[model samples]
Target: MSILGVDYGAKKIGIAKADPTGGPAVPLTTLIVANQKEGIERLQQLIASEGVELLVVGVPVSLSQSGAELLRDKDHLNKQMQEVLQFVERLKNTVTIPVELEDERLSTKLANGMQKELVKINGDDAVAAMVILQSYLDRKKL
Candidate 1:
């Protein structure tokens, strides 16, 4: 059994994975989809091919008043959160595996500050998914 992590977005969806042994998470690939249909199809294929038993989806939450800085605006952040939850629900309907959400507040920023070579190869979205997945794995161990 393996676990897959997703950093879902409007334009691009990031992906990462880790073994069931609670090993290090690795950036997989970014899905550049034109619409939700394409995104879901690609995600399904990846999950099947990777033998992912669980799906860890990033759910952005802001404790500070600034909110998700990537979103820039509070209203936009709220709107995006709704869309993300809806997408997650749709994803759950399509897959039999257990789906979970992880807090991804600073994942994108953290990913941006990662190794330059990694960023070049995986892109920010995939790296962000890695960060989100690794966090979950770490918490699971403790």
Candidate 2:
């Protein structure tokens, strides 16, 4: 089974793909967040091209407990997540794949560190999506 992972941002959505038969995940081109319609279209294209069996989305939760300020941010994230959830739901309809979220606390930072030794790095968003996907793979194994 192949899986598509996404790191959603306000401007750019990072993408990565991993197959159960393939050894490692590879980054795909970032998608500019147009409206939900365009976002779903872009993902459907990726799904068809990559043969995705599952979809994983990153959810940015806080590093610590919630407070008044944290609650405010939490509410904002919740609102934003609704958009993503809607996107995933729509994607699942077209792709007929399992769609879910992985706790994406600091996968972005970790992916950046992993790429630091490279000669050149492209979009961090796509790399971060790979990190999220790889983590899902590892946990699924356990």
Candidate 3:
């Protein structure tokens, strides 16, 4: 199965792809859009072009507290996550393929760490999608 992972954001969307054979998820491209409509359009084009059979979207949820700062940010984070779910709902409506939301806590941070360790590449939203997709793929293997 061809799976596409998406990291959704207000201004940009990150894309990554992997196959059922358990290959490494690769970062595709970042779509920058003015709004949700434009984002959906671009995403549809990507799904068509990439032959995606399933879509995995990253959802930021407050599942852990590593420090005191998290308590302060919890309310704001919850509100932001609600907006993300709204965007995910709209995206699901635009595609016929099955779409699933995976917990994406610390995906960006992990991507940043990976980028720093691997040198020679700049950081972008796509890296975060890679992290999300790879996590999903790994879980499926078990």
- lDDT by residue for model 2 over 1-142, one digit each (tens)? 5788898876788898887775677776689976767777788888888787788887665323222343344445677665655565566676667777776778788777775643135478888898888877787772
Between candidates 1 and 3, the one scoring higher on TM-score is 1
How would you encode candidate 3's per-residue C-alpha lDDT over 1-142 as one tens digit per residue?
Answer: 5898888888988888898676798888888899988988998888888888999888776333232343345456666676677777788788999887677889888887785633225345888998999988886771
Best by lDDT: 1
| CA-lDDT, candidates in order | 0.85, 0.72, 0.78
Tens-digit per-residue lDDT, 96-123, candidate 1? 8988878888999999999989989999
Residue 63 displacement in candidate 1 (angstroms): 10
Clashes of each: 0, 0, 0
**Cα TM-score of candidate 2:** 0.76
Order of all candidates by TM-score, from best down to worst? 1, 3, 2
Q: Best by TM-score, which number? A: 1
Query: What TM-score, computed on C-alpha atoms, does each candidate reach?
Result: 0.87, 0.76, 0.82
